[model samples]
Target chain A: MANTNASAVKKDKKITWKEIKRQKTLLIISFITVVYGFIFCYWPLTGWIMAFQQYKPKNGLLHSKFVGLDKFKFLFGDDVFIKVIRNTFCMGVLNLVTSTIMAILFAILLNEIRHTLTKKVIQTVSYLPHFLSWIIVTGILHDALSSTGIINDLLLRTKIIDQAINFFAHPNFFWPIVAFANCWKETGWNAIIYLAAITAIDPCLYEAASIDGASRLQKIRYITLPGIKPTIMILLIMNIGNVLNAGFEIQYLLGNGLVQSVSQTIDIYVLKWGISQNDYSLGTAAGIFKSAVSIALILVCNWWAKKTGEERLF
Target chain B: MNTKHIKRSLEDRIISVLIAIFMIVFITVTLYPVINTLAISFNDGIDAVRGGIYLWPRKFTMKNYTTVLAMQNLVTGAKITVARTVIGTFTALFANALLAYVVSRKRFLFKAQLSFFWVITMYVNGGMIPIFMLYKNLHLTGSFWVYIVPGMIGAWNMLVLRTYMLGLPDSLEESAQLDGAGYLTIFWKIISPLCKPVYATVALFVAVGQWNSWFDAMLYNRMKTEYTTLQYELMKLLSSVMQQSGSADTAKNSTAAITPITIRSAATVVTMLPIICLYPFLQRYFVTGLTIGGVKE
Candidate 1:
């Protein structure tokens, strides 16, 4: 028995050497990647330490005086910051609800369409906005919402309003405009997932419902709805974490003094206070706050998903 | 024919007709804004400002395109954008694919550890300031390398590619190994060629992302006007248009007959033209890519 164990150990050692020799290239690649991970990924995480410091560029992070929670206190104390948070949350929820509903509705409508050529064309046209840069979308939005643009012209011609409405200039319209813009841009692209999920539903289930004299609406309700529920649940759970990422580009572009009250998001605030003002610690603290809250939201949502036995990101 | 099958019901027919109308409205909804912009771009600058142009140019002119295209900023922005898209996409694809291949290797000793190391980045990050400061420390700020270097590997794409790699038959690698092919040889000669479908998918995604990205340009190279992207240029044109509109009476007395509306619309069109042109060819790949990524548990 002892001799057999000794031979087994010897064989394992021999294989280790041969394996190492064979894996040399892979090892080198892994080493480079690991180094990249350290520099780009891990390094920034370490730099989050500056969030606690009264950081000055001259003093560097290590030399900066540590100031615990002062930046947080200041951020919470600021009325503009609170308003920014409100705008962010409102836009975020609006975008999420509208885009998700539109995607689902569009997918269902597309599924009902029988003409292959028409369906193909519509699907192709729909995803075009998803590919467009926010810069381009914002440009389109600016033109369309301009005082003399088609929307205002139509409203005036229909006597919906006696005069042209500068949609972008109205603070109250900001959140809805952002939501509608997001829905327009993302609905088709987002619908692709639901369409895919719909395709994966068992055809037998539909047939079974049909044989039972289920109407079109009945079949859709009994099968299609339940079929994509998991996908919907998972997507919702995943997006819960993104409630703060209400976007920076569109808001920055479309927003002016007129709608700034409703347009400033947390990211914009970070850019304004953090990078633009050269207040490193303050920005870092705001960023840290955002990251913490986002992480907490994701965790709670994930835990709830597990408890409910619903589809979850984790 | 009537006797061969059950006749269509009124409700189904009505519902189908309603769906068709809804689809038509959807198409019009998506396309009208773009068509309006195109019309504005082609209209005479002063004519466009009078604001009757809806779907077609009221007074047709090519001057807006010609003049905006002639600007040094647009030319430089276009050059930088194209260079970034081509170079950034290929290098990032290669880096990401390599990392994906490494992690997807079933028997590689460090596969799980390395995969975990990269995956965590998707969930948590040091946030904007830390990364901005990090780039400053690395001297990537105000440099074109800022676009190429930091984006060399995207964790999400790497994971997607890794998933694709794992789906490939393991025997391909095992047989190659038996022939004494090194990992590099197997990766370059065997894995990458076989990975063309996924590679194309990832490449399209990365290229489009690089082409449309202006935030990076705004952050790292805003002051370096020569290094700005096409999208950034469009953004600047937009803001300038807004500023001019605000001070239109003063601007009307000073310069050429050009109006901000024409220039802005032209810039918007030019910014979107490439993607619009490529959409027909690229949509299928992106659709497939999305489904593959989306459906995976």
Candidate 2:
């Protein structure tokens, strides 16, 4: 029995060595990938120290003296930073609500279409905007919302308004415009998920509802929506993590001094302080704050999802 | 039954018509701006300002294109953007695919730990300041590698690929192993080939992201005009032109005549043309890609 135990141990060690030798190529590939991650994704993390230091390019990160939590305190004290946070949150929430609702409605409507060709065409058209970069979308917005743009012409021709409203110049219209652009860009793409989820529902359920004399809306309410509720809940929980992103390119492109008050999101604030102003510490502080908030939100939402017995991201 | 059927039929008809109208209005609202921008791009500079054209060009000219083409930085920017997109996407895919494959294996000893490592990074980043400082310290600033290296493997993309990989039947890998196939051989000969759809989807996502990205350029290549990306150049050009034209009243006798609406529209069209043309072929994959990442079970 002692001899048998020794033999088993010997075989186990030999097998492990054989396995390791056999998977040498995969090990090498994984090693390279890990190294890449370290160099690019992980190494840049060292710069986070700039958040604590009053960073200067000439003095370098190592040579720069640390200011401790002064940058964070400065951020809290800044009125502009406070306003930027509010704007980011407001825009993010607006985008999340409007885009999700529109996508859900669009998906339901698209599914109800009896003709496959028409549905395909609508889906194709809707998803096209998702591919266009914010650069192009902002350009389209700029031209379309200009004083003599198509929107103004249409409104004027229809006698909806006597004069062209300066849509871009107005701060009140900034968040709405951002939301509208997001809806336009994402609704079609976003609807594809819900549509996929809806299709996963058994066709027999729809037939059963029909036999029971349920109207289309009633069937949708009772069956289709409930079928995709888990997907919706999961997506909602996941998106809560991005509630501070609000976007940077679109706002940066569209903003001017006139509408800066409302258009400056957290991302733009990061850019302004971190890149433009060369205040890396302040910028890092803001970024750290944003990251922290995002993590907290995700945790909170995940907890909520768990408590409700819905799917959680983690 | 007759009265109820009639009322129901009428309501259905009304609802359908309302839906059709709403769809048309939404489509038109969304499409018209894009189409109008294209029209203005083709329009003569002077005629575009007169503001009569809506659906079609008036006094057509390609002068705006010529002018943009002649601009010194445009070609350089385009080259940089294209190079970055191609190289960045390749490296990203390679890294992501390798990592994902290893992590996807249930029998792999370090799979769980590696996945946890990636997920934690996703939640808590080093933040921007630290990242910039790291780049500067590493002397990566002003190098084209700055754009490609810093964002090589997206954790989100890795998660999606891992999920898709998990869904594949384990029997395939098991059978291959039984046939004297090693991990790398199975990955190359079996797993990689079967992952065509996911690969194509991720490639498109990464390519488009790299193509559209200007933030890194804005941050790292600020002083390096030679390496400025296409989007950055476009932003710089448009903003400068707009600044010049917008304050024409303040800066009277400034190049107001040169700041034609057609030139701006033309630049916009030109910058967007490559993406728009490439989108239709890629749109099919985009939906699948987004759903795979977004809708976690």
Candidate 3:
């Protein structure tokens, strides 16, 4: 019996080799993907080495002299970098608050609308801006808010202001405008999750509330809000991880000389200093800092979510 | 009791009326910019700069559309956008589904390890500088291939597709294998057909991503006009016109009928209209994709 079992095992090994040979096509495809992955995803990770080096493009990675944390020190010491970090966090927080509130409010308002066709049309129209590229959205904003455009004209006719205000020109309005633009673009899209959550609430709960003489406002406050709380909390925790990502495109496009101080994000800073100006080492250092902080934030938020007994990404 | 009933009905009526009014205002806010853009594009360019054109064209003309279409660069951009959308979406979907299928097979010895390689990428990346440096070294910069090649496999999309492929009945593949079919045949013949719903979902995402992408143009393809996407071209036009003195051509070609703003508004409409027109029809699929990919872990 032992001898037969050993022979059977040997036969299985032979068949395994044949099976592997049959998988050659799949293996080759996987190899190609693996190479692609390494070049695009993993290889750039090695470029993080430039963060600690003087990093001349001509010198490349190996020959570049190591500079330790001097680039980081420089980034920290620069007033502009400090201000850019402030701008990033400020805009991030502003966007998070305004967009979140607006989305939840829109979702709740949408839930209240009893007419089905009206709800569908409203939802369909509102989602249109979210599909548009930031370039087009920025263009629309630029056209409408230009000194000679409709917004300024409306403001003037309504006696809100005597002069037409170029909305993008002022640093004071930059963060709020960014926040408002984000809200305008994303509120409808973001409301989708909340709406889904609302739908999942047992209809019997609403029926019970109505039987208890609950007002529509009371029904929303009690039944609807609680039903969607878990979804909101999970989304909020996830968003907290992205607090440094204020945005890059809209800021990059809308920002002009006057508003640059307030408009520059960590991403735009990296692009400008790292790629555009060719300060590879300094740019790499900034990139490393951003990645590190992002990872840490996500992990911390996950931990917090776990502690609070909410859904954790991990 | 009758007074209370009357009061309650009256309250509900007022609430409904308020909601209707609010929704009207909301719809107007959403629709106004798009209609205003359409109006400006058709309005006489020089008249548009004077700024009272609201819902309809003041001095109606199609010259802005004609001129925008006339630009050789705009034509090139349109071609690039279409080409990239088709090629990028096709390759990305193929590669992603292939990877997902391979990883979904429990019989595959390296499934967990292979899947880990992609899942880890969801959390960590080399950041933009390293990626830019790597692309520069790869000679992918200044080429159209940069857009399609790097994004051929999105880890997040792969994971979602894998989850979907996993949910497909194992008996279908098993029966095919029993009939002497290989993994590729089984995947292509059976799994791909069964996975159409998810495929469409991922395809929409990839297509939209490719269509909307402009940053890649700004980053890698900036040196060449041939690779400029419609979005990137629109961005350039918008910025140039918004800048003082605008660009030289607009200033030089200054006709009595056309202004840069009108041209820009027309271009903006051009960039957005295709997606907008298809949106209502496509939105059902998109909403399903979002919920499916977003929820259920």
Clashes of 2: 2
Which one wins on DockQ? 1
Q: Quick one: RMSD of model 3?
A: 4.5
Colliding pairs, model 1? none
Q: What are the lDDT scores of the predictions, listed in order?
A: 0.86, 0.81, 0.85
lDDT of 2 at B12: 63
Fnat per predicted structure, each in turn: 0.73, 0.52, 0.66
Query: Which residue window of length 10 is worst by lDDT in model 1 chain B?
Result: B248-257
Predicted candidate 2 versus true structure: per-residue lDDT over B1-297, tens digit per residue = 664555555656776777787678768876787788788878776556668688799787888888878877878888998999999999889888888999897666556667887877777777666776678878899999998887788888899889889989887998999999888888889999988889889999899888888878888889998899878887776676556546536334434333356776777777777877887777667777877887764
- Model 2 alpha-carbon drift over 4 Å, by segment: A1-19, A56-64, B1-8, B248-259
* Model 3 pairs in collision: none
| Model 1: residue A144 alpha-carbon error in angstroms | 0.7
Candidate 2 per-residue lDDT, tens place, A125-144, comes to 78778877787788778777
* Chain B TM-score against the true chain B, each candidate: 0.95, 0.92, 0.91
Docking class of 2: acceptable
Q: Model 3, residue B86: what's the lDDT?
A: 96
DockQ winner between candidates 2 and 3: 3
Interface RMSD for each candidate model?
2.8, 3.2, 3.3
Report how far off residue B90 is in candidate 1 (Å). Answer: 0.1
lDDT of 2 at A102: 91
